[model samples]
Target: MALKGSFERYGAVAVASHWLSAALILALIPLGFLMQDATGETRLIFYRIHVLVGVVAGMLTLFRLLWWAAFDHRPAPLAASRAQHMIARITHVGLYAVLIALVVSGVAMTAKSNLGAGLVSGDVALISPSPIRVPPRLAHGVAARLLLALLVLHLAGALYHHWMKRDETLSRMLPRTR
Candidate 1:
């Protein structure tokens, strides 16, 4: 069955980017939180991995956003009422916002926070291969918090759609496409 509104199966590029991003975020979030609780070498190791993934995610976000604008390729809207449509659109956009926010926040936190000293790669020079002495204001007090809040909202919306609404909010992203 087809989705509602103009929502259609994402194109090849969109689908590929979507899945790659999903896998990365899914892996990164827990790893990041876990690293926060670690220290010394282990913390350093996770920090490096986190930065490595963040840089890649940042690149992917740019490409995906560009693809969305240039290719005009996106998923079809869900087959729901106007209210549902609005909620779906808001949620989807929020997802993008959160992902970008998280990526940018982490990058800023490292660069401006100068926390990069902790993110060593044994000798890898992915991004200057050094620690940031002071992460920016945007990355610290406000932006990072905003990212975390948006992430919670995004997850809540997903849960709402999945359990409360019993819709295909998450499922549609699957390859099967209903």
Candidate 2:
């Protein structure tokens, strides 16, 4: 497999970043729900894990953007019209925008709540089931829901291309031997 993308396939880096980000997002969603509902040390532990994973995922996102800016050379839309191509591009941009918003809001919420420093220094116990609602925290929740919707749309589009349109659109992103 090539480390750089070609007209027919994604690079190894792109494929790895895509899968890792997806996995992290999938894990983080459940963790977010659990942490929000939890209390005491349980919530604290979950929050720490969530924040750490989110940071890692955010770093991966940064690298993915850099990869696109510096090295991306993937194939064009195989048989799609100009309108379809535009829509695809919009969706991709929206996904990245939503992801960045989610991470930023989450980090801001953590800082505003003092969860990170408190967790480290034992300054305050993260035991509040009904924690204070700040703007960033609220935005984080909203972004989570929006991200879910975007992910569903992305999956639907890929499935449509693979099952109905009989295209390699999905396979091109899939991590498989060529």
My TM-score estimates for the predictions, one after another, are 0.68, 0.92
Could you give me the TM-score of model 2 versus the true structure?
0.92
Q: What value of lDDT does candidate 1 attain over all alpha carbons?
A: 0.64
Report the error of model 2 at residue 60, Å. 0.5
User: lDDT of model 2 at residue 38?
Assistant: 80
lDDT at position 107, candidate 1: 66
lDDT per model vs. reference: 0.64, 0.83
Kindly state the number of residue pairs that clash in model 2: 0
Please give, for residues 87-177, the per-residue lDDT of candidate 2 as tens digits: 7887888889988998899788767776767567654354365444677987888889988888888888899889999999999988876
